[model samples]
Target: MKTKPLYLNDCYIHQFQADITEIGDDFIVLNETYFYSRGGGQPGDTGDIAGIVITDTKRDGDGKILHYFEGDCNLSSGQSVQCHIDWPRRYAHMRIHSASHIVEYFLFRHSDNQKFLSSFISGGKETSTYEVTAAITPEIVEKIQHDANAFIKGNHDILLYPDENNPDYRYCKIGDIVYPCGGTHPKNTSEIGEISIKVKGQAALGKQKIVTTLMP
Candidate 1:
């Protein structure tokens, strides 16, 4: 059975109702899910499914997605379940995801440089880190932080087009500035609030590591 990925279409969906299709030794498969399976640098979503603490989620080959519970719960195949997500954590990820794109856009625009890659959400709790491929000099970090804030302050539009051929495609703009993306983002830059960046120095000879965050 195909697992419906609800979060992909709506990041704000914190709860959903689904039916259990199969149960495995290590995980449970759902007919549909709001829980994000670990992938795309972003971590999998966590929450509760029918009073069961969903500790982690992952996808396997053959297109089957699994939801791993922290402890055993009385769940049976064909049974109905209500899945709820940890919104605070998911929201943080949403912001970081958007902020990462903003950083990438600015880095490309200002540096007039391309080919630099690598981006993901790292670190954890009270201090999540958004890492991107770019040297994190103090000056550059400051500039990126400033630019990201400015963009947020401008309250630019964040539009999501589900039928744009590429389901992951996203567009953001401030006046005339526009760019394409394929990850979850806030409805507007203002939703991002405050942002900061720290360069982890050059990863290799020329590769760099940049860590970003939303100020708490």
Candidate 2:
């Protein structure tokens, strides 16, 4: 059975009730879920289901979200359960995830080259990073950092919508850049706070890793 991913539209939803559709040895699948599965460089959310603690979450082969507890859930397939997500943790992820995009938008606009070789990021409990591909230049880094911070301070609402003409594309339009992503994000750019970028100086010949992170 397919599970409905609620975080797609309402990233702030933390508590809900759902019926268990399938029960496995150590995991359970709900008909609907607010918990975010691991993807897009963001880690999966950990929370509680009823009284049972959820250890990890993953998406199955058929796109079903499986909430895995450390041990057996001991629940039936048709059982009803209450889900309580860790909002603080989820919100932090949303902020950092949005910060990454804002940073990328600045780089994409400022830099002369648009082909990014490779990038990576981690929005953990304490901190987050938005690693992008760019050359290690003092001027480039400074400009991107300044622009990203300005955009964040502008408090623009990050609009999340589908491509009406091209229905297959889901767009999260932030400032001038439109990203096709399904990850969680804050309602506005100000919620992402300040973004800082740094050139790692280690990448392909025409590429570099620009680390965009939160400061204070």
Candidate 3:
């Protein structure tokens, strides 16, 4: 059975209750889940289900969300489970993911429409990096950072909604700028807090990589 992804509509859901539809050696598939699977540069969510610690969340080839945990699960199919996600880690990712979008906007505007090739948020939760198709200079980086900070301080509200053309696809809109994304993010730009951006070296001869981190 296809599992409903609750987080697609609400990113702030830290805990939820669901029924187990399937069970494996170390993983369980829920009827519905708020846990985010590892994809689009964001790491999978780790949490606990009925006090059993979930170490990772992923989707199988058939599109079933597999919630993996350590140790033997004394649970069985059709059992009701109380799920709690690692809120701190999930929140950190939410902030960083939003920051990357802000930085990308500024970078594109200042750097001749430099395109993002890929992005990754570390499992360690220390930094989020985005690789672009073109080189990023020190001056460009400085300008992007300044513009991003000003944008954040403006306190723009964020909206995530389904694209009119495709309900399966989603858009992340911060103020006037809209980006196609499916990652979790805070409701407002100001919630991201202060961020620090730095160049993280090149991924290839022509690609530039930059890292963004949240400031304490």
The C-alpha TM-scores of every prediction are 0.82, 0.86, 0.92
Residue pairs in collision within model 2 = none
lDDT of each: 0.70, 0.76, 0.84
User: Would you give me the overall lDDT of model 2?
Assistant: 0.76
| 1-216: candidate 3 lDDT, tens digit per residue | 888888878999999999999999999899999999888888889999998899999988887899999888888899998999999999998888888888888877887634556788973233434445666878888898889989999999999999888987999999998999888889999998887788767646555677887888
Candidate 1 weakest ten by summed lDDT:
123-132
Alpha-carbon RMSD, candidate 1:
3.6
Worst 10 residues of 3 by lDDT: 123-132
Model 3 stretches astray by more than 4 angstroms: 123-134, 202-204
Error of 3 at 17 (Å): 1.1
Task: Tell me the tens digit of each residue's lDDT in model 1 across 1-216.
Answer: 878767667768888899999987758899988787876567787888888887788888866789887556689999998889888887887777777777766766665433645456753212223334444467766887788788878877666555468664555443355655444556777887788777664534555566777887
How does candidate 1 score on lDDT? 0.70
* lDDT score for residue 155 of model 3: 93
Prediction-by-prediction clash tally = 1, 0, 0
Candidates sorted by lDDT, best first: 3, 2, 1
Could you give the candidate ranking by TM-score, starting with the highest? 3, 2, 1
By lDDT, is 2 or 3 better?
A: 3
After superposing candidate 1 on the true structure, give the runs of residues whose Cα lies further than 4 Å from its correct spot.
Answer: 123-136, 162-182
